[model samples]
Target: MPATIRDVAKAAGVTIGTVSRALNNYSDVNCHTRERILRVAQELGYRPNQMARSLSSKHSKNIALVLSGFLEDTMLNDFETMLMKGIYQFAFEHGIDIAMYVINSRTQKEKSYEQLCYEHNIAGAILFGLKTNDPYCEALAASHRPCVTIDTEVRGPCISNVTLDDVTAFDELTQYLIDRGHRKIVLVHGRKNAMVSMERLVGAYQAFTRNGLTLTHDSIIYTNFLREEAVAGVGAYFRTHTPDSATAFLCMSDMLAIGTIEALKSLGYRVPDDYSVVGYDGLEVANYTDPKITTVDQNIKEKGYEAAHLLYDMLNGIRPAQKLVLPHTLVERESVKNLNELSN
Candidate 1:
């Protein structure tokens, strides 16, 4: 038989009410006392009755992690996987229950965000992969249910948007290229529907404008956030433009940058010698690549942790800032070559 809350209270030498508050994660509980109670509860094998807790408290302590339009065949990449790890760890530590759902276009037509939340008794949600024009995004923007999105901006009564500082990171990265004497830079961007891609494009453009450089529309290449797409896009670009035409390629993702490098190698061109390259979302795989990749590290795990905490705050009636832009850093690797070094 499982130990009861009374047993946990006795073991911790605290009142039943104190044990209850601590178990429920009440902010007012003393930190030391809460820790003690949790430790005692774990030792005593005390599990809170979810139904009873829900009945006593008006709000459900459940959160849903929704991944929108995730393809079944596609492998779960590092970003989403790391984000999920953070959210799962946070939820486990805070005693908040979490559920996951993958919604496709068909599901979007059949169920609304509110309905899903209601059906699952979810207090809030951490959402991902939503495009600006998605039907679910429209509903999420209109709904008052507390929702936190990664890299996508949505504003509502209880919505919180969390992501890395894309604009600043990209701007700094582009400026780095310009400082390295890269005059002709190619921008390999993600799909147009992704807001993050658009923000990155804006930042890259700003860097060029501030540096007194002109970028034509032809300098931009679009990809569907796929390595294969990047290979095709870069390959097509080289077919028309000379292999050495551009001094550098700034890709929106590490995969794209790796793909660009692979494409260049296939054409008998070398990286940082024939053309420098930089990538975003500094994934671990980038480090394993030959020459490695220079990229903006977005701290994917931290994004997930913060997103969960933000939703927890909202659930507790604390209105966090409308948008939280996490810090990003430029991870310098061997992919980019300084022309100044060549001159020297």
Candidate 2:
């Protein structure tokens, strides 16, 4: 067992309060006595209780990364793993403790966001996977706790959001397809309530409008951001609609885009030959695909670093900005074919 302040006090022939004052650099203790106490502490291998010390100073010295709405494989996904690496590195370098929590429907029912933070002694939090309409998001916005969210923007004095500029990302993606002479495009989207899905949809619409093209209501399909659902949605869409109806598909996520590719192959359709496919969220898994995926790289690690720093700043009463839009790039690969060549 390591030594405590009481043990150090006894060895140094001083009161526990005196030893604590010396350790805390209170200046009231004599220099000689303070030095003797520190020497005894060092000899006894006494390590201060960081948690208790933080409590005394009114700072928890701890932050939480909240992952909400995931039903399975909490940390196995490439995006979540990369984001967590950034947050973990930042916390380690800054000497702050970090706790990870996965919130699902059952957990949400058991504890509110504030309750979870309080129980964990978290000074601030970085929240992800929350839809804009989630009850926890609303509660977080109403509370004064320092919080930074990804993708969803919650309105509050202490709440900040970090996300890719979806409008610009998707606008560029759709324009890329348009520039290839693709006038017929299919849009595969995620959850309807998610803020990101809506933003990307807007960007897609803007691109089509920019090229003097109008998308009918049938051009859009929502898959709720699930792989199985995306496969089924694509299958169902093509059940009635011909493959020739759309020459390209703009998927809101790599997972969905990958599923679409698999579904097309299963139905004997070749990507970029029969139809081109584009995806968002430049997941590492995208590179392992047969033809590699063309998607928007959000630089998820940098976003995670920025989100953690944003919360850290907010905890210190420094409001950098209510919303931080990280830059993203379009990674072009073999998935997109030049429709102009086909026309020629």
Q: Please list the Cα RMSD from the true structure of every candidate, rounded to 1 decimal place.
A: 12.5, 11.7
User: Tens-digit lDDT track for model 1 on 217-319?
Assistant: 8888888788888889888998889756798999999888988999888888899788899999968889999889999999988899999999988878787
Clashes of each: 0, 0
Residue 191 in candidate 1 has what lDDT? 76
lDDT of 2 by residue, 1-344 (tens): 76788999999999999988877666588866865775687668665687345564434356888998655632356778889888887887887777888886556644556556544566688999987767787778777678899989888877899998898899999999999999999899899998999999899999998889998878887887877777888898998897679889889998889888998888999987888999998899999997799999999988898898888888877765489989998999889999798668
- For each candidate in the order shown, give its overall lDDT on alpha carbons: 0.83, 0.83
Regions of candidate 1 where Cα sits further than 4 Å from its true position: 1-60
TM-score of each prediction: 0.80, 0.80
lDDT of 1 at 222: 88
Q: Residue 184 deviation, candidate 1, in Å?
A: 1.2
